[model samples]
Target: MRELSVGEAARRAGVAVSALHFYERKGLIQSLRTSGNQRRYASDVLRRIAVIRVAQRVGIPLEAVRRAFSTLPDERTPSREEWAKMSAAWQDELEDRINQLMNLKEKLTECIGCGCLSLTACALANPGDALAADGGGPRRWTPG
Candidate 1:
């Protein structure tokens, strides 16, 4: 089997070297270590990286990708049937997200129309005023 050095793999995969390291750390990909302690990747890693990139572009979380990958064998590129099953699962999740976003978009207009705090329909309702239970101050800003 053909093998690629870390730098070469990163270049061919169109990702930073650090990103490859991160993926390996996350158990999303694996590498072989040489006697000199250098990382080497199978040529098939290029295809795996492509799948990861496509999944991220479609809003699939890394954890979900990891889970799906767990269902697949690591010996070779996923077979057509394997890909079909994985894609179908991702498709279903994407459909649910699209519906949720559409519903939110519709509600956003309504929310903008009225800033009333009384209506449960208020966009920032916080459902059951849950945020208030935590504290009265500003909540932490979570970065993407």
Candidate 2:
């Protein structure tokens, strides 16, 4: 039942203190307050931080990561089974993404031989024509 001070956790987690604070606010991690109102976290938080970093590297959005973690217990440390389940789900997603990328690569290779590399005709190079009617691209939701 060891606990780490904020500085120690950030140093060990290889993340900035502010980032750690943001994670806590995002419900990705939790902490306890000391008498002086400073933050302290259980050693198990190191594992949570690692998972968050890996999830981000895999292109999983923060909101999705938060939702995935919601299925896990917060009070107790996660067991290997718990991690395995999450990893299994993520693996499926990665496989699907790989398939999509491979399909796109095949299409582009075919286009190369078809002399359709021109931006006006190339779906791979300029998707703007198809995407222009899709509400002007992805929306960036910012809090007002």
- Please, what is the whole-model Cα lDDT of each candidate in the order they appear? 0.75, 0.79
Q: Return the clash pairs for model 2, or none.
A: none
Per-residue lDDT of candidate 1, residues 1-144 (tens digit): 678999999999999999999999987888989999999898767867888897787666677788778898887667878878877877876675577557666666666766555565575565434333323435431213
Q: TM-scores for all candidates?
A: 0.67, 0.75
Residue pairs with colliding backbones in model 1 are none
- Best lDDT goes to which candidate? 2
lDDT tens digits by residue: candidate 2, 25-95: 99999998999998989887898888888777766777788888888899887888998898788787678
Model 2, residue 28: distance off in Å is: 0.6
Clash number by candidate, in order: 0, 0
Q: Local error of candidate 1 at 58, Å?
A: 5.5
Off by over 4 Å in 2: 118-144
Superposed by TM-score, candidate 2 places the C-alpha of residue 36 at a distance from the truth, in angstroms, of 2.3
- Least accurate 10 contiguous residues by lDDT in model 1: 134-143
